[model samples]
Target chain A: MKLVVVQVLLIVVVAVVAARLFRSRGARAQAIRRLGVLAFAAFAVVSIIFPDVWTRLAHVFGVGRGTDLVLYGLVVAFLSFTVTTYLRFRDLETRYTRLARRIALDEAEVRGRLEGGPEH
Target chain B: MNTSRQVDTSGVWLVIPLYNEAAVIGDVVTRARSVFPQVVVVDDGSADDGAEVAREAGAVVVRHPVNLGQGAALQTGFEYVRSRPDMEWAVTFDADGQHQTDDVLAMLEKARAEDLQVVFGSRFLDDRTTPSLAKRLVLRAAVGYTNLTTHTRLTDAHNGLRLLRRDVVERIDITQNRMAHASELVEQIGAMDVRYAESPVHILYTDYSRSKGQSLWNSVNILVELILR
Candidate 1:
């Protein structure tokens, strides 16, 4: 009964997440990402319902257990998420730094002019 | 003290970056102005009156609207100095009062004598310089990393004090807007094949400076920045 409840909960969560991801406005890459996520979620549901199916698939992929395969996939997915997030932050920081430098240079030029110096 | 000969400091400019250094900026600017003819302090958007204090100490002050890192501050100073037609040399000093003004003058003399484009001050070369064992190890690791990547034989990789010629300053631009710029500068110097020298200089590591300076974890972050970026 607990297993049935967990499966239902997982399906509900994945459906909501997949729907949100699909409805969100973004580039074509995002759509492809949503598809990948949905497919992975469906595979997770299948593995949870039919435990032996995972073991059989694991053997084909040369794995000893299905849990190990899922764990490895989660690790890779997490690392990719971290890298993408870092890249986004890095992009934002670059833009901010440029803005800061421009403001600084403009202020210095004005101050120099007021002090009777040549235009910088 | 050798007070016999007066060194000519006619067109040299000292650029000191201050960030919440209200306790020491005033004295540092005053002392630096005594040695260098033109002292320019870049207040990197500090919350305190570091800019006002530095200006009161007779240093030319330029304020950033927001707090950028030390690298951004130094670049601002460099940009300001580059605009002046009479400026011949640019020296980057620390606002924490760890660097000695006399050593700056000595390095200036050496750079002038050797016609060097850049002169970096290294604390490891001086026996009087004292840092904790852990700090020394971190610095040594930094040196090895810098040397390995830049292919330059530098004893200290992250020294705050440096003297650059006007032409050399015009050649390269500082892109790293933080502590990582130290390593970036070395890489640029090597890539550009600029004429550079390393001088043994004194660095007074006070409790305040050690606290304000880079921590070990930041060193790891710097390594990551170097690799990923």
Candidate 2:
């Protein structure tokens, strides 16, 4: 029963992420992501229903346990997500700093002109 | 013939970035004004009357729209200085009243006499500016980290005082908008192959600066930024 609930939750999350990826407006990229998500979701559901199948698959990869494989994949996925998000934020911050600096310099120019000379 | 007497500061521009430093900005501006004629204070969106205070203290004031960090503020000042064709040398000074006018004079004179591009202040070069054991340890660690990363043998890595040619400031861009900029500045200087020298200067530590000092968490964050960047 617990395994069934876990599989349902995993499928729901995968569906949501895959839906977002589908709407991301890239043809080849979206198709590749959709295929990847579907494959993972199918694997998760099959592993939930047939626990021995996961063990067998894990053995093919020289792993002792299926749970460990899933855990390792989750760790890699989470780290990649974090690093990509951080890079995006850093780019945004650089643009923001440039905007702030431009505004500050413009204000100084106007103020300086109003005062009848450059700002000292 | 005294080379010191011949060192010219007629084209020097002083840039001071102030953030809610109404209490000490006036005194610092006044002191800096006596040595350097062209003083520009970048007000980093302070809530108080820091802009008015600095202006009244005889320095030109540039106001930012929002609270950016010191690095942004200094960049704004650099932009302002760059716009003026009369300026040739630029100095970044702290508004916390910790730096001395004599140090600025010394660095400026050195930059002029030696025809160097950049001059950094080194407190460790002079024993007069002794800090507490904890602060010293942290600074030493900072020095080690900066030297390792930047590959420059700097005696003091995080000192806030510097004198550089206006062209040098124009060449290197400041992206780290906070405390991390100090490390970034050293790294850029090394990368640009800019001729740089370190001068022995004294850093006065007061209760106010100690109270407003960076926390250990912020230091860790700075290290992460440096490493990641």
Candidate 3:
């Protein structure tokens, strides 16, 4: 198979996105994510206004068609979205676990006091 | 019951993570309370009256408002045990009555005799526990994966029966809120610099526990959780 410029670029971008899924998470990461989203939205508007722009850009990147480029972009976006959603749910679970544990312990403590304390 | 031969196990607390095991939880709690005076059953939002049964059977029941997994229930029990200054040891026992109280006493004895901080109840240490061929294969694979990932080497890593000293219990923070927590616990304990040993335990696979046992397919889920975490 002939290696195309777009293939190499897509591989690099996908690798970076995958690595970002496991990398550091903080204000900086959040800023970068927001910036990516803003850029994506702006590009979406541009593509909608000028549909031929993706074909011209695709030609520069050695891709077959604009639709192919969009497909590749969608794959990367979906992968990152899945990973981020999973991590966010995990964080939510941890927080709720701690909260539920506190309530359970506190309730048990109150019940113990009301019952004259835990029996040995 | 000879009072003179009784060992002073008042410092030991049995932490049983209870779910909807209303059929056998009462008898399990009663039997465990007879051997270990301090028993705390963490009820993980059971629809049945298992929590009430545990309470009536003389166990300190800690009820979660919603249904959390067994791992969350165990952590709740651990937190509850940490609050009590009188508890010097905490044993994580199963609520399904598969775990033997005698094995708990033996593990405690081993911990005390060797001055160990952790004593894990391993079914593969001896031939006492007989699981089916398929179940045995899954357990073997689990232990193998655990040993490969963690620094510690053990015959069984997914066993629910474990004796942990107060200090070790205080340091353990289980984040996996499901079946994956077993491997997570072993991984955390392996990372900690604590003296640990494994004792042979007989896991009785009664009809009740057999029905409640985790499906073999959960091993795949556990692996995904560990890897994704």
lDDT of 2 by residue, B1-229 (tens): 1233444667889999999989999988987787776899999999999999998998888888888899888888888899889888888899898998788888987887798999999999979898888778878888888888885889888888999798798976888888888888888888888788999888888888878877667778888777554
Grade the docking of candidate 3.
medium
State each model's CA lDDT, in order: 0.80, 0.81, 0.90
- The residue-by-residue lDDT of candidate 3 on A14-44, one tens digit each, is 8898788767578987888899899999999
Q: Choose the strongest candidate by DockQ.
A: 3
Clashes in candidate 2: how many? 0
Q: Candidate 1: where is the Cα deviation over 4 Å?
A: A1-56, A118-120, B1-4
TM-score for chain A in each prediction: 0.60, 0.59, 0.88
Instruction: Report the C-alpha displacement of residue B112, candidate 1, in angstroms.
Output: 1.6
Interface RMSD of each: 4.9, 4.7, 0.7
What's model 2's overall lDDT? Answer: 0.81
DockQ, structure candidate 3: 0.80
All candidates: DockQ = 0.29, 0.40, 0.80
Q: Which residue pairs clash in candidate 1?
A: none
TM-score of each model, in listed order: 0.82, 0.83, 0.95
User: Can you list the residue pairs that collide in candidate 3?
Assistant: none
